[model samples]
Target chain A: MAHRWKNDLTRADATPYAAFMNRRQLMGGALGLGLIGAAGAARAAEELVPNSWEDITQYNNYYEFGTRKDDPARNAHTLTTSPWTVKIDGLVDNPGDYSMAQILDAMTIEERIYRFRCVEAWSMVIPWNGFELADLLTMAGVQDGAKYVAFETALRPDEMPGVSYPVLDWPYVEGLRLDEAMHPLTMMATGIYGKTIPNQNGAPMRLVVPWKYGFKSIKSIVRITLTEDEPPTSWNKANAREYGFYSNVNPEVDHPRWSQASERLVGGGLFARRQPTLMFNGYADEVASLYEGMDLSKFI
Target chain B: MSIADRINPLARKLPTWVVYVLYLLPVPVLLYMAQTGGLGREPVKALEHELGEIAIQLLIIGLCISPLRRFAGVNLLKFRRAFGILAFVYVVLHLLVWAVLDVQTLERVWADIVKRPYITVGMGAFVLMLPLIATSNNRAVRWLGPLWRQVHLLTYPVVLLAAVHFIWVRKGFQIEPILYLAVIGGLLALRLIPKRARVAA
Candidate 1:
C-alpha cells in the first residue's frame, strides 16, 4: 500500500537511486502504481526506459537462475546478495577480486531505459539503473590477450535446486567478445524501477548486453575471466541449434524453431496483438556498426 | 400383452445410473473450458494456460489411480478410464493451443518437436497415450488381457515426459513445477520399488 498511484509525468527525469528507491519502497514496487497513474498522459512523452510492467514480468529470459518466467524470481532469493564480490582474472593485466561494496562506492549508478528482447519472440522496455560495463573493465584493467570476457554465477546447487538438472555443467556461464563486452550499451545492472534490485532479480551483480537477446545479459556474476580463446558457453554447449554463440536478435536469422518476425508482448492481452521484432531489437543505430559486413547468418 | 409389457427389457436390465454417470464423465473438461474463457474473450492464452494445467492434472489423476486402489483400498478404478481420456483431451488441447496459437505453423511445430529436447519428449508421451486411449473399452481390455496393463504402464513414461515438457518450456526452471515433478516422481517410484510393494507382486 506504500505506492498506489504515481504521477510519472511530473516526477524527476532521473530520481536519485536512493530517492527513487525510497518512493518505490513506499509503493511496494508493483509496476505502474507510483510511476504511471493513467495511460495517455505520457503518450507522446519521451521515456528513458522502454519497457512496461507487463513486459518486465511476462518476457522473462533469465536462464542463469532457471528456465521459467517466475523461476529466477523465486530461486534467486538465496543469493548472498550484499557484500558481494566479483573475481576479475584470466588474461587481464590487473587481475584481482573486487568487493561489491567497493564497486558501488566507487561508481555512480545511472538510470537508462532499454528495450529487452527475448529470443522466444517477446520484448520489453525496461528502465535499468546501473553503471556501465566498460567503466568496470576500465577499472579492472583489461589486457591485450583478452579476446573474450567470460562470466560465472555462484554454483550453489544446494540453495538453487535448478542446478540439480544434469542438463549441462553447473554454474551457469555466459561470455562475450571483448569488443561486445566493452560496448557502451552493455551495462552492469545494479537496480531497477529506481530501487535496489529485488532478490528474485539477480542482485549484487549481472551484465546487461543490450542489442543481443535477453539471455546474453548474464546474471548473479561471481567471476569475470578474460580469455584468449572463445570461452565455452553453457547454452551453446547444451543445445547448440536453438541457442547460438552470438545469440544476437536478427530477423534474418530465424531461430531453428520459432518465427522471429513477431513477438507476444507480455501483459498485452492474448489476441491483444504483438509487434514486429526489429533487427538487433531496434538498437541498430548505435550497435549495428560493430557487426557491419559480418554475415550474421554464418556468425549466428 | 398389456401396455406396460411393451417396454424394452434392455433398458430395464442395464445400470441406468452408471450409464448416465459414464456418459457425463466429460464434465471436468467442460467445466474447465467454461471457467477459463475457453469460450470467452481472452481465448488463446486462457485456453493455453488451462490446457497446460489440465494436461498435468490429468496426468496426476492417471498416476493417482493405482496408488488409490492400493493404499486407500478405494475402488477409484471406476474413474481411471474417464480420467485418462480426460488427460488425453487436455493434452490434445495443450498441443492444439501450442500449435495453432503458440507456435502457429505446421513447419515450425514439426521443427520444434525435432529441434527441442523437451518437445520431443512431450510428443513421445502424446504418441504413447493414443493406443491406451483407443483401447479404453471393456472389449479391447478383455481382448488385450495382461498386455493391456503392460501398454497402460506407458503412463510412467508419459509422466516423465510431461514433467520435462513443463520444465523446459520456460527459459528458466520454476520450483513450482519441480515440486509437482518431485511428488509425481516419488509416487511413481513408490509403485515400482520392490521394498515398498505391499500387495502380492
Candidate 2:
C-alpha cells in the first residue's frame, strides 16, 4: 500500500530559486512592504529568504568529509555516488544490497521545505525532494521484534579524509525509535532545490528528521538495520555528555557547551539577528506525542 | 637598510594614534563584508569568529615583542602598550558579538559562561587581562612600583587560558587551534630561558 500521509506544508513556503539568489533585492522589497504592515510583514519576509545552493553545499558539518565547515564542499565531490547500494538487514524480511535506482523506484518522491536546526545552534530552511522513510521501511517488511531503525554511512577511507583522523568512528551510525522512524515526517532525501543532492549535502541518499538536530539526519547512508535494541549513534558514542541518544532540537534542554534557546539563521547575511529556537524545532504538535511523558532534558 | 631598520624610523615618526587607526581599520572592512553579503551564510557567526581570531593574533603578537627585542635587536617596546589595548578591544568586541548577536539573551549568556568549559576559560582569561589592561599606563607603572609587575604576571596565565579556550571550543582535533597553542607555548618557552644564557647565545 502507498503511504497515505499528507504533508500540510505547501510549495508556497519554499523560496523560488531566483529569489533565493537575489535575496538582497527581496530584502529591499520586504523593507518597503514592512512599512505597510509594520513589523509583522518584515518578520514574515525574513523567513522566506532561503539558503542558496552554494551556502547549503558549502557550509556543512559532515565529519566524514572533514571537521571544518568548508571541508565537505572541498572534499565530497570525489564520492562515487553513482554505483551506491544500500544494505537493508536485521529484523526486515527483504534484506539485500538495494541499488540507488532500485530504492528510488520503490517509493514516490515529493518536495518538502523544512527548517533544519543543527546542534551547533545554526539553522537553514531547505527544500528537499524525497519520500517518507516509512514507505521504504514498509516495502522491506519490518518485523514485529524491531524496536529501532539504525542507519549507517559509507566508510570509504581513501575518499573520506576525516575518517583517518578518528573525528568519528568510521561508518558513522544513527538510529531512531521504530515509531519515530515510521512517522510520516521522517524522510529519505535524494535531492535539494529540485536538483540531485550535492555531494557535500549527502549525495545519493540521506535521512531528514526535521524535528531532530541536523546530525540525527545522517548523511551518505549505505546500511539500514531494523533492530530490537537501541543502536549506538556516532556523536553520542564519541561523547555521551555532549550528544544525547535523542538529539531533538529543544530550547529548554541546552547542550552542555552552548545555549539551544536561539539559532543564527544561515543566508541572513551580516548583522542577521538570531531567532528563538522552538521546541522540537517547531514540530512539537506533530512529534511531541512520540516522546509522551519522558523527560527530554535527561534524554538530551 | 634592513627591513627592521627601515621600519623603525618610520615607526618612530608615526603618532601613537596610528596604532588605534590601524586596528580599527578591520572593523569597517568586516562591516562592509557583512553589508555586501560577503560573509557567506552566517554573517554574524563569521564576524564573531573573525574578531576572536584577530584578538588571539594580537595577543600572540604582543607576546612576541620581547623576544623580537632580545633576539633580533628590534625594540618595539613603545608599541607594546598599543598592541595590548587593541587586543583588549577586539576581545571585548568578540564577547559582545557572541552575547548580543549570537546568543541573544542575557540569561543564555550567563548560562553559557557558567556551563560551558570553553566559555568559562575564555571569560577567565578576559578577567585576568582586565587588571593588566587597566595598569598599562605610565601613571599605574610609576604609582604601584614592583606590585604592578607582580599583577602584570597574570599575562602568562591569561594567555595560556586563552590558548586552552581556543583548543576546547573546536569540534575535532583541528590543527589550527593546536598550532596557536604551540605558538604561545614557544613564546612562553623563550621567556623561561635565563637572561645570561640568552645573551651568551
| Best candidate (score: TM-score) | 2
Best by DockQ: 2
TM-score each candidate.
0.66, 0.86
Report the lDDT tens digits of candidate 2 across residue range B1-201: 776797778778878788889998998999788677676556787788889889998889999998987877677778888988999999999999888877766877898899998999999999988999889999999999999979987888888898899888877467778989999999999988899986677
lDDT tens per residue, model 2, A1-300: 334444454467566778767865665576566442333233433543457887788889998888867789889998999999999999999988899999998788887777899999999888888999999999899999999999999999888888888667778999999999999889999999999999899989999999999999999999999999999998898889989889999988888778787777787665565667878887777899999899998888
**Candidate 2: where is the Cα deviation over 4 Å?**
A1-3, A13-50, B1-22, B71-74, B196-201
Q: What DockQ does candidate 1 have relative to the true complex?
A: 0.14
Candidate 1 C-alpha lDDT tens digits along A1-300: 111212233235655689757754554452335333222222224334355543453334454456555666656667677677899999877788789988887776876667677777776667777887878887878988788999987787666766777545677798999998887788888887787876555676778877888878877789999889988777787778678888888877877655685565555444443455667876676778888898888887
After superposition, candidate 1 runs with Cα above 4 Å error: A1-49, A52-67, A157-161, A164-167, B1-50, B56-77, B99-101, B104-201
CAPRI grade of model 1: incorrect
**Deviation (Å) of A189 in candidate 1:** 1.1
Candidate lDDT values, in order: 0.70, 0.85
Per residue, candidate 1 scores C-alpha lDDT tens digits across B1-201 of 533244334335555356436534554665466455443333455567667776787788778877765665444566677778778877887788778776665776887788767778889989988988889889999999989989888888888888877776654335667877898998888787574445455
The local lDDT score (0 to 100) that residue A76 gets in candidate 1 is 68
